[model samples]
Target: MTVAADAPPLRRPTRLAYGFGSVADGIKSAAFSTYLLLYFNQVLGVKASVVSTAIALTLLVDAVVDPLIGRMSDLTRSKYGRRHPYIFAAAVPAAFFFGMTWFPPAGLSDFAMGVWIFGFAAFARASMSMYQVPANALGSELTQDYAERSRIYGLRYWFAYAGTFAFAAFALKFFFVATPEYPKGQLNPAGYVPFAITAASLIFISILVCGWGTRSRIPYIRQADEREASPGLLSHFKEMGVAFKNRGFLTVFGFAILKWTAIGLYGATSLYFGTYVYQLSSGQLALLTLDSFVAVCIALPLAPKVTKWFGKRNTSLWMALIGITLGTSPLWLTYFDLFFPPGHPLLLPTLLLIGAVYGTMVALSLMMTAAMLADVVEDDAVTSGKHNAGIYFAASSFATQCASGLGILAAGFVLETSQFPGGVDPALVTEAMTDSLIAHYVPMVMGLWAIGCLIIWFYPIDEAKHLANVERLRAREAEAKARDMQDAPLGAPAR
Candidate 1:
């Protein structure tokens, strides 16, 4: 559908405001992915299997709620606009529930704790989905230029990485620092409360600022076609069907599922790998948090240029390959003592360098994938005669949730089967347990990322195909406008 006006090219300020919103996402993701399982299983003495199952169930809930929110936003005709209303509304609840996930009541049984985890996790994830699905859809609505879209997403990824880096560093340095009672800061139960509060406050402020900053663009944003009847339930399902049929959407969707599953596994296991496998202290771990910040500084500027040179799909595939190699090689070397011994002074610095390289690849790959998805938005509009960015993004979100859920579930099974104990000291972790962690971690992460790279190779849309699609869509819209003018009543104003 045509917008109310020719949408202006996104200004640098607007791009920055939009990108800033991702800091909230980055904070929530860092907290949930990196620390949730560790906090519940190790700090609170809940079983790893129980925490994993609870999170997996919550993600399953998101699989339903995410798309519904997207479809609702797609059809919504509120005065404040389709996306911003939900984006603003989600801030408080998302933050509140997220905080609650970290602060369960004292003296609960394992079952009760699991129940509490499930309830809070579900609400927290759903609230974020309410915002994230629409915010992502809004990115496609912001601009139509292909190269410009890459730049926009590059900015978003940079902000996201920076935010994650800041949060991790802060937590490691201040909240989770080693104490007399708890040698590893992460094992301390007291630090999590302040961590939750800080993260929640940031989530609230970032979302509100983004919502307010972009409010002026409401006039230029696309609205539902007034001429068409309001969609019924069946029609909403039909819209989802149409979105899934687009080959470009499927390409991105499939790749994201595999890639995110790998990421989910990595996030779930990173604490264990760092603490037990590599024997890193909280202080040393904090130093490693700088990797993403360095990557963003290097990769954000390079993303658009690389996309211009190799095309989005090719760039994404190559970057994923490189990322998997860089991310996994250090671990393999450490395991086999191929390089410096694991406890050697130089090993941490060498690992940090590898992390930096991997992080840069990850940032570039994500930037390309987001840009590729924006291209698919235009392709969908051309083929379906509807701009269903929300629906498309929601489907992608669904895949992401599903992948993360399965990954958590698999992690739980591995932990239980390997007989990993809860509330244990890092020094007490057995060699067999480290081997189990490595076996589960390496294959899931490296293999799935490799598979994602392969899947992305078949993505049909290229720069040429996307530009052709945009032209065809412009012609179709022009023809529709002409027909509308011709059919207007004698005294009525033409739409």
Candidate 2:
């Protein structure tokens, strides 16, 4: 009878543990999201197509496996806690696999290299899932208060920024800039060392934090009895079909997919603008990252209040519209050549504008995404006979990964098509490069397909419906629990 409101707010230590898990996930995921394609293409000497195929194949297989993992994690049991044990167990292997992913051997065929890359990447991804699904499920069931979930998720995103800053500011430069032996002119796969070390070090520390830090908030749920569940693969498929056929759930999933894809494509292409077009050096990239880090702090505290004032739907819509404006301010600079000389002093103004606006949206949108997911889960439990927050989160996770994988593919292809050689002088800004970069940025910035994001974001799952749905869902689940109890002792005494 742990009603959502009746459950006390998470303790300080528990919140810290949850924050650690969020930070760890952010750190581990940051490398994959931001640097994987670049690492494989430039540092490890893999072709763009090869990197794309490897990532795409890994994700395709995982698309199915990840959902199953979420369901299994939901069904898991242990004294340590249902979710915590898998999280703790996955840490070491995740670290190992993340490192091995970047360790390319010499003189291997592209096919073998692709196989090796896919294997390690898949292992690392699956390992993260062990911790992430349960943690997300734990988030929903932690409290019933709508505003409180936003606060927890918002704080988690704050630390999530810490990871974002760490990976963004250092990981690439550390790979392409540091490593004493590789020096400045080296082109052999020797560049892999610094990248591997960086990935290994960050993910290892993240694993430790998430694994050890989260042990205390060990909320566990009992597995459903075997007799009451889908008894075969055919039944499982039927259940899955029913789950997807729920139009409301499908709407939420669509928004999540589009949102993450937009974010993912942006991540994969950032280096292009920095390195190829504006021709910023490692130092400049670090500064830009610092800009984003600071902006995240400014926007974090305000997100909850904004949601409260506007409600989740309008809050998200306004943020997106404003974000589209602010985020695309850089596109306005594409017109700078008309008003000022190519070497105009106002050049710095455009750069600063891009950095500032980029930072704002980066921070403001954190809780908007989290709140939408909360609504989606609430709707699911209300409409379906059972609650499956883990599966819904897994669906989001899969979409994000797929989007990221395709983006890696597209980014690699774009850079290769542009024929921008790597390890070239970082300061050589060129007109051709600027034109190409602007070509890509203008569409995304001008909110071309962003209209699609709007359509998906506005699906009918508003706050009132979510609240009503939760009440109904909770009643049904409680009744089902009562019936189970009555049936359990059919021929025996109650424990």
Candidate 3:
């Protein structure tokens, strides 16, 4: 049955209903977030240094455009509403070009290749921005109940990770492994297009799933506001500024930035470790599928309990610590390969546990942070006498882009220094390059996550404060509705 607006938020049908599309969303995001930079260097034959510069520059560009886009979305008007139209519009283009980005072409010098990458990548990211910003912002606006907000966000993110983790685990080998011509590597014709096509298909399909599943449930809340405000563009911009002024909102932004930077660094290294250092075949890389699955298994069920015990803020902090400690094992475990064959001595077991804890934390971050952003929006509504969900969520999304930008730039730079490909034959990675990669390049990433942990350690907001705010807002809303009832003109009744 259709439910009342104030009904308690958590329900299995909704959870199940959201899962398919959410997973698809995750796969699309995970592919771009995790793979594209390395693909540009190793497959498209763009030099690591040039690719690094191009990505870093693009990140800066997105950083510039992100919040503005969010503001624009808030002001957007169409028959379909503020968010969905853009999401639907972005899907096909995002799919086609994402594949195109991966396709390698012949006869281009590094200069022309760099220009091509710059133009296509900018468009690719812009297209994704068109969708992802609203998708995340919409999470908070889905319901007003605090717990329901948590449930919706938790389900959304759990599915997101499921898709991302599962995709990362196998998509690499699924497309490129069977084809041998890519062994030439570094922008070879065989390697680029095939990999691009595979990634594009996954991204396009995943977005469609999200577009389909969320259609019935999502409300066009922005369209429903009885009294709209401001000069459209300026209104969105001003609202974004207002949202950013909130201290609580800023804390969520820090976590998003630091946490994702940590994740990005890991994705960049995972390929190097799996392919170059561990000397795993593309087939072996498929084992990552298990790595992500185990993590999701642990997190999905345990999320509520973890948040209940530790509370969201402390829970996030504790999970980060756990990840920092457990995640380091993979690096040192490299030594164990000597005693046991190439397979992980404690690899599966270790990843399994880490994945569980990591997944829990990842989902928690997605849920709690999104919920918190919504609360911050509420704070404004209570203070300003208006409902402004879009602007608040947009700023939150803007902060996310900044975080992604830093992570991508960090990845491009670290890889640039390793003397890859042109310097060392793909036929055999130099012992020196391999050693340098493991000893220097790889270990440094753990430090990045560790630093991310440290930054998140100081994040604001607690369960007590959040609940108190919820109570205050609820009371205020009741009072506002009562006044409306008293002031009703004839048949107007209470809204």
What's the lDDT for residue 375 in model 2? 69
The candidate scoring highest on lDDT is 1
Screening candidate 2 with a backbone cut-off below 3 angstroms (N, C-alpha, C), the clashing residue pairs are none
lDDT of 3 by residue, 360-440 (tens): 555565666666677666666656654556666656655555556566666666665665563334557755665555565
TM-score of each prediction: 0.95, 0.84, 0.84
Error of 1 at 360 (Å): 0.7
Give one digit per residue, the lDDT tens place, for model 1 in 29-79: 778777888888888888988888888888778877888888888877767
Worst 10 residues of 3 by lDDT: 1-10
Stretches of candidate 1 exceeding 4 Å from the true structure = 227-230, 483-495
Instruction: Tell me how many clashing residue pairs each candidate has.
Output: 0, 0, 6
Candidate closest to the true structure, highest TM-score: 1
lDDT over C-alpha atoms for residue 254 of model 1: 89
